[model samples]
Target: MTTKEQLTVIRRLMGFAGPYKWFFIWSVVLSATISGINVFLPWLLQTYMDRYLRTSNATIQIMWMFAGFYFGGMLVRAIMQFWQNYSSTMGAEYMLENVRRKLFSQLHAKGMRYFDQTPGGSILSRLMNDTMTFANFWALLNTLILALFAVVSSFIAMYLTDVKVALWTLILVPFLVMTIWYYQHYSSKVYRRMRERLSQLNTKLAEAITGITVIQEFRQEDRTSKRFQKTNQSYYDTRKAMIKTNTLLLSPMINLFYALGTALVLGLFGVRGLHEIVAAGVIYAFITYLNNFYSPMSNMMDSLSDFQNGMVAGSRVLRIVDDQTLAPQQHPVAGATITRGKVEFRHVTFAYDQEHPVLKDVSFVVEPGQTVALVGQTGSGKTSTINVLMRFYEFQSGEVLVDDRDIRDYPAAELRSKLGLVLQEPQLFYGDIQTNIRMYNTAISDEEVRQAARFVQADEFIERLPQGYTTPVLERGTEYSAGERQLITFARTVVTDPKILILDEATANVDTETETMIQTGLNKIQENRTTIAIAHRLSTIQNADQILVLHQGQIVERGTNDELMAQAGYYYDMIQLQNAAHKD
Candidate 1:
């Protein structure tokens, strides 16, 4: 990448360092100070050896002074090192937490389109792995800064002691720099590929774990394992390539340069010593400085890979932060509130892909306190209709109005706050039954949660549990029957008391007994509330105020169930098909 682009990435990542900016600055200052001390220590040793120890009149007091100076320098360096490490670690952790918060907030702000297109595993990788890589970025940056100071300060120290030797050592500097540039140029691409492969591996793993039951039931474990192995092997290949690059360009190449520089200096000092032009003490100090030069060079080469990897990870993280596809949850100004819960879709046309419309010029109205049922085959746009009403997907050329105001104008959070959705497969979180009913909304009281469960008759089964309202729900509520989970879902919806209720195939997974219980709960919640339901069971929605039959993204028929049955249209045919299937 160009220098400008790298700087832009660094600047963006640094923006998250707001909470610990001073800490980071102090850490860098301490690192530079430590490097300066290291550079000075060798010179102090040179002074002591040549000026004091070389004298026949050397005294015990002088020896004590030299020891004191050396020990004092070590003490100061130790103190500074502790503070530097503490500051860098604190800053990095704070920045990482802040970054995670931002990323999670962005994910929540995004519309369903983002979730539909992106895999859950890829998002997980970005959240956990990429954020961790970014955390390492601070340490890599610190190392680079310290290495710069060490190299520059060491060069100055060497030049002061003896210019001729320093000039000769400078000859190897360009070659070392070129080696680093070469490693960085190649390693960046390798690390980028490695990170991408890791994300893919994570994606596969998430899918496998989530669908493990399906895999076992279908007897596809061998197939699944093979697929995972392919991803795993690809990731392994990238790691091997990275290791090879490191072996070739980092420590091994650095050691070679160090050896060559050492040999040339020792030969120069041997000749100079014959004429007593350069002192034994000066030669010793120069050797120490040369080692100091190579130490930072080796460190820089090792950290270059981390720097490049961080850059790649940071770029991925920034993409999500800068995503513009999210619906605005908080508007600059509030829109109209839905006091009566009237919903209307006028000339609605939507397409997940523009080439194939999912809802085409559909129009409907659910008057306040009425239940409208939508019936359709798979891909007949039944769920798509509900998705548009919830403002999950952006429609093309349409007005979805609630209370005579465009839905787009309302803040997303405010709009959703008044709407309650119950999915076909009820989802239960890990929490006590009462907390699940409240969904952790602090505004809900324990009494309110209990009353909502009672209203849905879920209190019957809930009270049977060992802890009753306080019973701990397992992951996804797997310990409960499908019916039990659905009943709790009803309680959850009732507790919210949303102005408008949407039931999307909410009865599809329940048995007859459970369906009866759920239907009773549904009836209670639908009282004096606007509701839209999508159901495949023809009998369940017979009492709907209006029924719309959708086919190929268009409403083929619409009316009260009796009105549509009298017309003998698509709705009538669907009922007949269901009845025939039930009889068989």
Candidate 2:
């Protein structure tokens, strides 16, 4: 990123801290207080040496009083340091939490097309690892505040001791400024590359774990391992570059400046001591003030690496929040709802990528309480039609209507609550049977849960388990068979009592017996609801009220089962192929 872009990203990230500005304000106040204390403690010793010790008037009582004042200043400095650290650290933590939540909500608001084009692992990295850097991001501000206060206060004290020495010490300022500029410009590039490498490493690991079953079955473990090692090595190389950049520019350079500045301050004093009397207290106060001037710079320089890392991470996170590939926009009229669930597509055209259409001028209608099955070969647009009708993707140049009104007129909540969807693979979370069936909808009572389970013919097997409806489910319900998992999903949908039921080739993965059981449940549920079914197996949707045969993103024929068979067109050819496969 360029300097302008980096500043823009930093500004956006700081916006999250607006709600906790008081904490930062207080931290700055405390830092200034501590700097004042630092200046006073050094001068107290100078006062005692010059006024009492040099005149040989030092009594035991005076000695105790000086010691007590020095100790009291140290105590107050410690207290100020505590509050400064606490307020600053907590404020940054709050900002990090808010940023993570906003990112998560933004991910949910993205359209299916966004997920289709992005990797799961890249998204995960930005949401989890990148967001965490923000908590440490504010440490840079605290260090900067301390350095600013310390530099000004210590310089004033030094100037009061000897104006000529103080003026000469500033020769190091221009060189220090040049070093800082070089580090920010170069280290930012290194940190950006480092963040990208970390994201790539996360991507490879997520891909490997998700497909581990396929990999082991195909005996591709060696190949996967080698690829992961290569990505890991790239990440390791970036770390080496980052460490080298920090070592070259941060504490080492700042410490070098401190050493040179100190030599200049003392060398001026030594020349004066030869020609005239230079008070011991004056030399002591001048050296102490010089140390104060340089110490905070070393700390600020040490935090520069975190500054760069946080900027890169913050930019990556904000990119998602600013992405335009959002879920389809809806213009709702109040009181509009999907009551009857009559769905229609009026010459709809749709595409995942705007340039190439996957659905072309598709028109179809399914009346309430009727079942319409979509049949076609792979990529023939059967699923695409369902996706458009379901309003999962924005259809280009078309109007999708439900209940004789534009689909967008209905509130999103109404559409989601009334339309039920069952995907090809059944998904279950880490919950018990009853909870999954109701989908954590607390309003769905135990009686309704059992009724829905029985409605889907899933009650028999579920009741046989020791814990029955309360049985604990593990990751994705791995303990359950595919058929069982799917039946539970069926119960999940049934419990919602949807007006329109959607099935995306629900029986393609089950065995013959489970398919038969699923069909029986499906028949009862389709009694008085509008249904849209996509058929992977030709036989599963043979009894649909109307069948639409599609080819190359267009509907070729539409009729009843026997009506389409008599035409001996795409429908008949598909049937013949399936029948032959069954016999083989």
Model 2 Cα lDDT, one tens digit per residue, 1-584: 67898789878877888898898899999999999998898899999998899988899999999999999999888988999999998888887888788788889999898899888999999999888886687867787888899999999988887899898989999999999889989988899899999999999999999798999999999999999999999999999999999999999999899999888877888898899988888888888898899888888888888878888888888889888898887899988988888999899888888878888898989999999999999999988887876678898888889999999888788888899998889999997999999887999999999999999899999999999999999988989999999999999999999999999988777788998887888999998899999977878777888999888889999998899999999999999999999899
Q: Per-residue lDDT tens digits of candidate 1, residues 206-266?
A: 9999899999999999999999999999999999999999988988999999999999999
Q: Give Cα-based local distance difference scores for all models.
A: 0.88, 0.89
The parts of candidate 2 lying over 4 Å away from their true place are none
Residue range with the least summed lDDT across 10 consecutive positions in model 1: 327-336
RMSD score of candidate 2 (Å): 1.3
Backbone clashes in model 1, listed as residue pairs? none
Compared to the true structure, candidate 2 yields what TM-score?
0.98
Model 2: weakest 10-residue lDDT segment is: 134-143
